[model samples]
Target: METDFQTVEQAKSNIQALLKGIVGTRTVAIRDALDQVLAADVLSPIHVPAHDNSAMDGYAFNGAAINPAGMTQLALVGTAYAGRKYEGTVKSGECIRIMTGAVMPEGCDTVVVQENVTVQGDQIHFAPGAVKAGDNRRLKGEDLTQGKPALRAGRILRPADLGLLASLGIPEIQVMRKLRVAFFSTGDELRSLGQVLDEGCVYDSNRYTLYGMLTRLRFVDLIDMGVVHDSPESLEAAMNNAADQADVIITSGGVSVGEADFTKDVMQKLGSVNFWKIAMRPGRPMAFGHITNPNTGNAAFLFGLPGNPVAVMVTFYAFVRDALFKLAGANPTAVPLVKAQLASNVRKRPGRTEFQRVRLERQGSTTVAHLTGAQGSGILRSMSESDGIMVLAHDLGDLQAGSEVEVLPFEGLI
Candidate 1:
């Protein structure tokens, strides 16, 4: 295992290079495929707006009958409603009243809105320059053409995607199988909830936080393995058990350079693992590799995170979230960062990226980030009280008040 320090970007790139989406796909109805990854490209089977129809409630007439500079008049033959078509051909000096989405009558390619025409018994009068040729007619295949790709493979189906599929008359689609993820926390000083609070032992908060984070990703089947004691035998048994059932395994703590942290030894013995000291604050010590179950030959991707509460969340968002999406056959998108001005000056070192918790407030038209209390890796409440985590880049130092910064909001991320 390599213990050299790596930049955050380098770490991310390395992790991405070593992983691929899990295999296997199954057909599912569109109704049950929300947030699921598409296994194949969805092609349009038929043209949208199958027939030429009216775009507005108006009179449909041939474009040749339109008077460019003077008043044009035509006899109103009949009225057409949506989902119905005027059967008879529209001859010269004749038109038909058509509602929105109604199929245009034969030889009628334009529509003069009802508000733009005057009714005089059976004759409809159009004012000068009222409408142009094909002004309000919807052509067939205008929205989507048949035999064309509607949604590509590796797309995460959303509500809008479902509607688009329904519009194409698709009842079912193929989607990648749900990714299985098993996670747990490791530390002798950590205690489960409802247990006696002994001296020098604190309640484990990382598992709960990990649960919340993993649950947000609807495509993942979460397996919470609870807390494991920091022993080589315990760590190996847990890793073997998790790898047999899950595609990915996550552990917080026991990967750091401490005597009590036996995770590094256990992981290296089981498989080829890399221990990394990433160049980022709140989360620095991390391990990435695959743990194999020797008996079953089943291996799972592993993420060994730091022990701190805030560090677990930060590292998971920065690294694990996208990796999970990728392994689940999804085209993962990075969380967007918005520009905001700082409320006060902050001190920082020059080579490490820092994620500082801050509350956002609107100052006139500008958004300002107010620093939260004591930005520490162990302070979990710092994340709770803040609206976002301002990312101070690696090269920045001693930012002055009112300086601009990039912030990842907690609204969608947390």
Candidate 2:
């Protein structure tokens, strides 16, 4: 393990270089494939809209029949509704009353909206240049061409993707199998809910926080290993057990340097683990690499995060979240950032990257970021009250009030 701290970008790149998406895949119905990664590209079996159709409730006629400088009149011979077509062909002097989505009559290519025509008995009259040739006509294969790629491999299925598949008449699709992740919190001073707290112990909030975040990722299969006591034997047993069952293992609290930090020792002994002191605030001590169960020959990726509640969340968002998405065979998208003016001056150094909790306030016409008091790693309430995290980049110095900054909103990510 290198004692020198790694930059945030270096740590992310190193982690990604070592990972490959899971290999296993299965076919499932479209309804059940939500948030699942596609194992294969989906091709459209047929053209969408399959035929040339009318896009509005109007009168369909050939454009050449209309007189350019004067009112044009055509006899209305028949009507066409959606899902039904007019049987007869339309001549140059004839038109068909067509509803939205109705198939255009044979020999007719343009549609003048109903509002643009005046009806007199069986005759409909419209002014010249009402609509050009092919106006308001939906052409065959307009939305999707037949035998074309509709969805590509490695794409995560969303609600809109499901609708697209249904439109292509695809009932089921091939997707990567769910990734199993085992997680637990470490520290002898931590206690679970409903347990009696000792004089020196506090209730374990890391596991609950981890649970909420993990649950939001529908593609992940969670294995909550609960809290493991701070002991060499206990840590070893849990690590080996988790490796045998999960593809990835996450632990909070034991990666930091302390007397009871036996997690680092056990991880290094079992696998090729790299302990990294990242150049970032809220989360600095982290461990990344693979751990194996020697007896079963089963190996799993591991993320050893810091002990503080806020640090766990920040590290997970900054590092582990995308790592999990990539390992599960999905092409993850980066979360977007919005610019906001700072509400007050911020005291920041020039080396390490910082993520400060800030409440976004809309004052007058501008949105400003207000600091949520002291930004300590143990302060969880600040995170709860904030709208998003203001990311202060590495090498950025102190900023005066009203200076613009980038913010990562908590709308999609908690």
Q: In order, what lDDT does every prediction score? A: 0.89, 0.91
- lDDT of model 1, residue 232: 86
List the pairs of residues colliding in candidate 2.
none
Q: How many angstroms is residue 172 displaced in model 2 relative to the true structure, after the best TM-score fit?
A: 1.6
Alpha-carbon error at 14 in model 2, in Å?
0.7
lDDT (Cα, tens digit) per residue for candidate 1, span 1-414: 133667778889999999988999999999999988999998999998888999999999998988877889999888888976567778988999899999987789999999999999999998878899989999999988999899999998999999999999899999999999999988788899999989999999999999998888878899999889878888889999999999999999877777464567789888989988988998988999988989889999999999999999889988999899899999966778978998999998878888899999999999999999899999999998988889998888899989999998877662
Q: All predictions: root-mean-square deviation over Cα? A: 2.1, 1.9
Report the lDDT of model 2 for residue 390: 90
TM-score of each: 0.96, 0.96
User: Model 1 — which ten-residue stretch has the worst lDDT?
Assistant: 1-10
The numbered model that scores best in lDDT is 2
> Which parts of model 1 are misplaced by more than 4 Å?
1-4, 259-261
With candidate 1 superimposed using the best TM-score fit, by how many Å does residue 12's alpha carbon deviate from the native? Answer: 0.9
TM-score of candidate 2 to 2 decimals: 0.96
